[model samples]
Target: MEEKMNSGLVTSSRKKLTIVDTDVHHGYRAQSDLYPYLTKFNAERFAEWGFGGLSTHLYTSSGGLHGQRVDFDAGEAGDGLGTIGDAHYCSTRLLDANGIDLAVLTGGIAGAASALPDVDYGSALCRAFNDHSMEHWIAKDPRFRLNLDINSQDPLGAAAEIDRLGSHPAVCGVMFSCGAPKPFGQRFYHPIYEACARHGLAVTMHFGSEGEGVNPPPSAAGFPSYYIESRQLRPPAYAVHLASFIFEGVFEKFPTLKVAMVESGFAWVAPLIWKMDLDWKGLRRHTPWVKRLPSEYLVDHFRFGTQPLDEPADPEAIKHIINWIGGSRTLMFASDFPHWDADDPMMTLSDQPEDLRRRIFAENAIETYKLSLPAISQAA
Candidate 1:
């Protein structure tokens, strides 16, 4: 689908601000596109088992479109599907059309790879996906950056993958889908974080894999009957991970580490931070290693993507939330492109002050991802 923004809405001082989309999902037009990247052993194994796209089960609530925008041409379903054509179609349709300066490609490998029971197989799948993305997506467009997916089941392998690809000029960060075997801050995953810090790359945790494959149920109360219910679980899931990262002193261990919570809305963040600060005041003795209030770490080391921007009846409420969360620095723009719920850059958060809008749209992302911007023709 072609996504164009209303040019008037994005102009700041009569200049269209460059946009940095932190969470664009570049999908495989077909499963077979990855075969050439997969090892001979794994390729044969996949053939026997049948290709499992990113998720283990179909998103029953996607209403047959699987959460993709109905207008998106997924190309035909045959050999050489996405590889043959439309591979860079999204880049032209969305980024170029909308004046996006840089987009981080969060591919669909993390969930499926993390869900595999065989750790070796999961690692192999991750490697293949990274290789495929490098050749087909990042190499095709200098504007597209990568968030290399890793298999959390094998942290060593995940770290090795990061070390191997972290230096690529277009690789910006490391990504893990929300559903993992354990909380991200656990010692088991420290090596992954260590590698990210070493490479000066940020870590992005996107919402995916909940209740699918080997992931536990979507919510603590148990699985919900409808998709809306599952959607509600996303914020809390991010909250849990954030709390885990804070209380466990992950930030203290790697002070330079930056974490971006993609697709999870930011409205709930202020309240959660307030509560954490309140409890920490009384419970500081338990986790003495945490040097400051929980919220302080978040402000310094974490960023929230602004895709599912909260829409309150009063527009002022959105501004209030942004201020409470530390202004423009705490949020970054993410299109979640090609997905059914993707936000329009010109439309989402349009009411914010121009300075804040510019920061969210570009500056915050560049700083968070440590991006080196390339020259592009300015929007007239």
Candidate 2:
């Protein structure tokens, strides 16, 4: 079945899926349209930061961060490694185009998700990006929602934006990238977490380059010189974010704050949380401010996306992650969609245990992102 919109468009009626993409990088694809709103500093900084052989077509000039273009054939339109162009891609090309339902819009831009300046400039750009998404991409469709990517530099500025933007009917939550110089445990991001708790907006952290704007040679770690080493570093960022919240007492401060660690593989979560619990049990004397075990804090406060699945991802492995992280409820499913690395959405879900099918596919994401179905009757 299909439903008709006020705009005279028809979309899929399937309601079992609600994709809340946490690691999107589409901003690089739309940079030309967004550049006019960026400050002169953003443009100048972007060029100055380019290293040899990495001449970029998309990036803010101020920090040479928050932007990178995707490559695709002219005929592909917004179809790149992992992007679908605009609302059409979400509704038509992918979901309706594939018999799926509901989509939560997030950025595919690196810089937008990075620790750019502070939350002030970061928040302004976020508003601009959301405005652009709603007007040009979502086209006011209630089903296609947005999440604000906040700068970790200034948590207060981020908090202010979350208060302002979270109230906007179109926004679903706030996003925090993990690679900032400030380790996640610092007090720098508390205000943003506080704001999210107040507004009831979910907080998201995606896995990727921290956009430190610096490159590391493989020899530093004695790892082989290959592009994969760069990618391996992505998952560690999540641990940093988790450690920040757990050790810093952010969760204790705002118990209701909902946080989701996206794009990072779920496999490591179980072991990491175990290690965290052990560390906290012994290290509590070191940081007397923390009132509980870090593992207990994570099980209560965090959620992880299940994608970039381990090769030979056995049912036992999936089950083990669930058990380690506390339960099946903490695992949410995602395709990572148009990115070259995205796992096949269908294959990922199909492999799950029968009892876990519904919760992982959509139910958990709805709770994590705080999105309601709009009551089918209400949609009409």
Candidate 3:
């Protein structure tokens, strides 16, 4: 059954299946949009310094929405990996079109902001972005939710920012760039996690600004020579953060906190957990705060987004591997909408069983994020 909206549009009944897209990138058309929310000093700095952020963009395609579908119009300019668009365009092309119930807006620049060497500017940029998001994006649609972007380099400021906006009705979680100079588990970042746990907000690690600015190489071995290599190393980039979260006992400290890994394939998850579980048996003494098998903590506290999901030679191979890792319980549906590689909800897991599809598309996210589903209003 479909539900009709005030706009005279229809969507799949929420009662039937609630499609909560975990990863939807949104942002300002340019830094100028942030000026209204930015402090005078920051606004002036932005005017002069321009976007002082840097990343290993040298290895990735800088065109076509970062290789996103450039063909689809976001109804605003700078669809080329930008923040110029709004909810109406997205609704027409993605949400209502796909019958999606809710789509979390994971603005692309949040992670990149953290990559900046200038901590104050990074934090200010994030604050402005957060304010801008509330006014422009989240305010525009109930279907939209925001993951407040943060600069990990300024733990005190980041924690303060969390306390400032953690309780907002539309804000869902906090996001960190995977290009982080240190493991997420390090004490340097604890203040941010502590605030997140206090507010019961999940922490999201996403790809951005790796191998540039203050951030170290994307991989432990170091930066890759080419874009393809950079793409392949994406999963490992998350692996380091995951390992830090587990080994550093971030989960043990913040039992209520959750972390969602996005834009990273799930296939690498199984191997990493296997080795951690095995090594933890002997290395448990080194980190005594960890009270359980590493795998148990990860399974309990972590969630994964299925975007850019790996499609192996055998179509069924992903299903089997997903089951081995965590299956429907751990996976959540994400379209990465407006991006060239955005996965359509219907086309993404078509081969999987309907039961798993339903769980991944909605139930799992609701549980992990403790989502507050907005009341459904039917059109007369």
Against the unseen true structure, what C-alpha lDDT does each candidate score? 0.79, 0.58, 0.78
**Count of clashing pairs, candidate 1:** 0
Error of 2 at 234 (Å): 2.2
Off by over 4 Å in 1: 1-15, 50-58, 63-65, 76-85, 377-380
* Residue 163 Cα positional deviation in candidate 3, in Å, after optimal superposition: 0.9
lDDT of 1 by residue, 32-145 (tens): 767898888898887667434444543465532455666556562113211123446766677766777788887556776887777788888788888988887777887888
lDDT per residue (tens digit) for residues 92-211 in model 2 = 444443334456655643333344433355455555555566566555455665777565566666677677667876566776655566666567667777788777888777753344
lDDT of 3 by residue, 195-230 (tens): 998888889878878877877767768867877777
Task: Decide which is better by TM-score, 1 or 2.
Answer: 1
Q: What shift in Å separates residue 116 of candidate 1 from its native position after superposition?
A: 1.2
Evaluate model 3: give its lDDT: 0.78
TM-score of each: 0.91, 0.78, 0.91
